[model samples]
Target: MAFECVSRTDVGLRRKVNEDSLLVRTERGLWAVADGMGGHEAGDVASAKVTEALMRLPVVYGLDSMIESAIVALQRVNQELIALAKGNAQRTIGSTVVGLGIMNGRYSCFWAGDSRAYRLRGDQLIQLTRDHSLVQDLVSAGMLDPAEAESHPNANIITRAVGVAEELKVDTVGGDVMPGDQFLLASDGLTRLVEAQELASTLSSNGPAEAADRLIETVLARGAPDNVSIIIAKAT
Candidate 1:
């Protein structure tokens, strides 16, 4: 199967710089989104390092092998960032990553922090990755309402991310891929402002290019306060 992919990034209305990075290698069937931790030193560098590492990953066959390679690559970048931070007086420089890999009719999503992956199969839209933020944990435990999680003052406090600790934990999920299936990888900037129903409808009505354009446009229209990055891939 072949994938038709499109990607875009914006600094948004409030941010002075875009600290989000994306990768779209259609021939390799690999795509990713990385969001730098806001208000941190060299956030753009941290996110760029993530995509740079993923871009260098060796080609591997099978969904399992693809996921493994990505994990290894990310781990290396994690260590690099950690060491760099220590040299700079122990300031944390981190980034959240979400990636999608496809091989032999199957798809895999691997991630850390709050960047997300979603699948649009027919009329159904499913979130494939979960946020590692404190707010997400509270919501999962039923201590906080879902509607309130987004506005919680600690919504930006992520529990895990590359460069945040010596050891990084990345999560993976996968399933069989079908023709006409659509996949989306995005930073929280877009997801925070746009609702899931709107995402599903946009993906269902347009191809990769148009869908990506509309999503970014919607985020900017809603007064984007953070960097936004989006990638859309459709199987054929």
Candidate 2:
């Protein structure tokens, strides 16, 4: 199997600290990104804790095992964070997950909440994970148009997150991994500022490391409203 060329994370312009975490397993060619929710520092704790849990999962496995393991790990972190919040009383914490793990030349990804994964091949870019957010639900029900939903006052109100619920049902995507394929695993910060085509352009122009930098620069230039984390990798 070919390697995943690059993976990285950066704090965006507006946030005090990066509440995002990422991991890359060279052995399995896997990559992941998490966007944290909650205030009062709990968000950072939640994302870091969950990412550490996920990193423990074995790299050798089918997509199902990886996906299920991630869910279970996130569930455990959810319980831990909930317990921590009860003690603090002044804080509540949650996190969104988006990840990619590859095996036998196929890539599988899973997500919770709005953090997203995108696949860019040739001239097209496809978003693999759906956002588990109130606005997305409304869009699906045709209760709101996509453009209006983007700017809605409650647009940031996520309906589901990894550490918010007792159990997390992470959504999944599995597909072919062509040699030239480019994958993007990102926190909501980058997507909220840059569109799919723009992302595709960035991926096509540079290597994963440079692409990651460009992605952050784009968000910062646009005045990132939230903490951003980005991972851009290419099939070798």
Candidate 3:
């Protein structure tokens, strides 16, 4: 496969801190976004550890292994966070994870929380990750409309996340690669600000780098509510 890539991250207008963290390892053909929760420095530390560990994965592994590796890494990060919290009187660090990797002409993705992954092929945009938030539960239970989910008071209260418990179960998915296919990985910061179609349009033109810029600009225009980070990869 052949393609180009570009990425961008920004601290949005609200929020004094950018708890979002990301990992882009082109050499390893990997990318990830971790939107940390909790207050204080704990969020930053949790997110950073998750990304850092994933960046060091084996040079080559099947989709299943990659998912396994990611889960293991998150478990480790969770333990680290719990230990940190135990040491401090007021520290709760948690985060959402969404990531993708390509190898041998195939692609793999894994996610927990609301950060999303998307595929653009032949003008069609497909969201690959499902939000694990409380709103998603409400929608499934017929308590709310899809649009209202976004504004739900507990919109950010995730059902699954890193460092929230002793163990984590990640949703892993993969697909066969195709030429001219484009992939996107983004944190909830951006996902909450714009719809998926809006993102697809920004990436419809330009290579990854330019696409990344356009995405950031669009979110900022929407009044960025949180730290936003985006990664784009094109397959040839």
Strongest candidate by TM-score: 1
Q: How close is candidate 3 to the true structure, as a TM-score?
A: 0.93
- For 145-234, candidate 1 gives per-residue lDDT tens digits of 999988899988999999999999999999999999999999999999988999999999988899899999999999999999999999
**Consecutive 10-residue window with the lowest summed lDDT within model 1:** 57-66
| Cα lDDT tens digits for candidate 2, 84-110 | 877888456878888888877788888
TM-score for predicted model 2 compared with the true structure: 0.93
lDDT of each: 0.93, 0.80, 0.81
* Candidate achieving the largest lDDT: 1
Worst 10 residues of 3 by lDDT: 58-67
Clashing pairs in 2: none
Tell me the tens digit of each residue's lDDT in model 3 across 1-236.
Answer: 55577778888888787788889877667789988874546687778888988887765466667667777887888788777777886556778899897887888888888889999986788988888889998898998999888878888788888877777788888888788899999888878878877777776866777778877888889899789988888886
Error in Å for residue 101 of model 3: 1.6
Total backbone collisions, model 3: 3
Model 1: colliding residue pairs: none
Residue 108, candidate 3: C-alpha displacement in angstroms: 1.5
